[model samples]
Target: MYGLLEVHNPENATSDIVFVHGLHGDREKTWTKNSVFWPQKLLPLDITDARIFSYGYDANIAHFWARPADNRLDTYSNDLFSQLNNRRAETPAANRPLIFVAHSLGGLVVANAMVDSASNSYQSLSSCIRGIAFIGTPHKGSAKAKWAQVGRQIIAYFGKSTNPELAKDLEEKSEKLAKIGDVFPKLLKRRNEEAKGRIELVCFFEGQPMNIGMIVDESSATLSGYESILLNGNHSEICKFGSRDEENYTKVVGHLMKWTREFENSGTTEEAKKVTNDAYFYGTNNGLQQHTNSGTMTLNFGMRN
Candidate 1:
């Protein structure tokens, strides 16, 4: 997932766009599957003079999210971002603006890398970053994590460390549940203050009946300069990076087109609006459609607690 990004450079390419996938996903599977179609669909329309690239990391949904406070998984954001910067330096591409296209946990990774100085690479990379598009990312913590905590406790009582299988499973569950309540909103607050006018933040969320709203209202929300949009798709299918499905693919392309237009026309800052809703704001996209049946489905890709 690291190294030179493969892209199509039309003559006179204006800028570059970086596509970052969520947890448990990588360059090939994440946005490349369906979302990759954006550039081709919008190029003639003049949305951007951009090319697409993906970032990779070592992520395990079962363990990483369960242990949010663990420094190992948390450090991935900075480590991967550093690789991206090195790649860009090694190969000079079109001088077009740089935009970050992230999904689910990927958004959090990007947000953390941008705001936190704990990672030395963050400060330098933040300056070059222009825009950020987050799909189904929980800028704030998700209720799903809270539910996972219950499951973790159950496993702890019955399946404690005496048995390796039980112990490992229990740990995985605990780590993911803990992550749901951690990071996100806190990261957003830090990101907003650090990046300020340098980065343009846009959120595209799932608005279907089962789909939850991005940030699900400002209370859970923390990021600033966020222009959010709602779509009629489940957490699994929201951004079909490289999908052949015309309809699903188009939804993402359309949003990108609109986002590019906004970036091209307006300056860095966009008006921030107040969102309203309770904890169960958008509800959960339950049933088999969620891709994971352990419990509740995740809004961003397959990362679930």
Candidate 2:
């Protein structure tokens, strides 16, 4: 199932939060450490009033004789957009405030998704997004990307490497990836200019280094104007937490809580509340019918008299 899954849904939820994993990362495994799934086990304890979800995709940069050649970063972003938009559309959560927490290349996908949502067709998707927090995501490029290119070449020498354009896109200074890095910030800037629901963005960088040196340096993992937090682990460990009190979890969850509360008090998502209706019939209005809607309405209907 390469789509979104609702991992946590509580009564009277105030927002919907999605988790997108990075290259070669599983939706659940990316945020789990020592067999503890933080989003399910730890996060809900702190973020009690928000629904949680995780999106999965085939993120391997280079596959040894893998499936189709159509799988690319652009394709993944579009998949995420389609899945998220359709899942929320016409549902009680359609206009609810949304937050995206992504790691590594998942951040790029989130960035591109954010930019794509600006179009008129995806206005609902754009307006619902309230905050984004990226962990060890390569906003520019990372050393691991260069390694992916090298790995591709090494596998191609054996005639087993499938052509993966996403590898090239992730390479350090690749024009395509750079374009995403460039346009993403400007899109957020435009949102600020509109003075509408300005999306809150935060970049988290890994403080330690992997055996291949730091995978993503601070300059590559962060934007200029937004807030950036430094986590106390390596690229692989920055998102993993064995307990709620871990420094990484504390810093990250603290920001998520703060943002959720801010969105609640701001009333920015008032338009997207749950779709419900009530009617009263009196006198000769026996055949009266009532219809009310919230968010992007679809064909589905439910009624109670």
TM-scores of the models, in the order given: 0.58, 0.78
Candidate 1 — which residues are off by over 4 angstroms?
Answer: 1-4, 32-48, 66-70, 91-96, 141-198, 208-225, 241-255, 258-305
Worst 10 residues of 1 by lDDT: 271-280
Q: For candidate 1, what is the lDDT?
A: 0.51
Q: How accurate is candidate 2 locally (lDDT)?
A: 0.73
Each prediction's number of clashing residue pairs: 19, 0
Residue 94 of candidate 2: its Cα lDDT? Answer: 67
Residue range 1-305, candidate 2, lDDT tens digits: 47888889887787889999976688989889999989999999998999899998887654211223433666677788788888776355667788999998788778877676666367678777889999987764323454344344333432334454434543442444556667887888877776656888899998988766677778777888989999999888998888997988999999999999988876664465333232222222233334343332223234334
- Candidate 2: worst 10 consecutive residues by lDDT? 276-285
TM-score for candidate 2, residues paired by index: 0.78
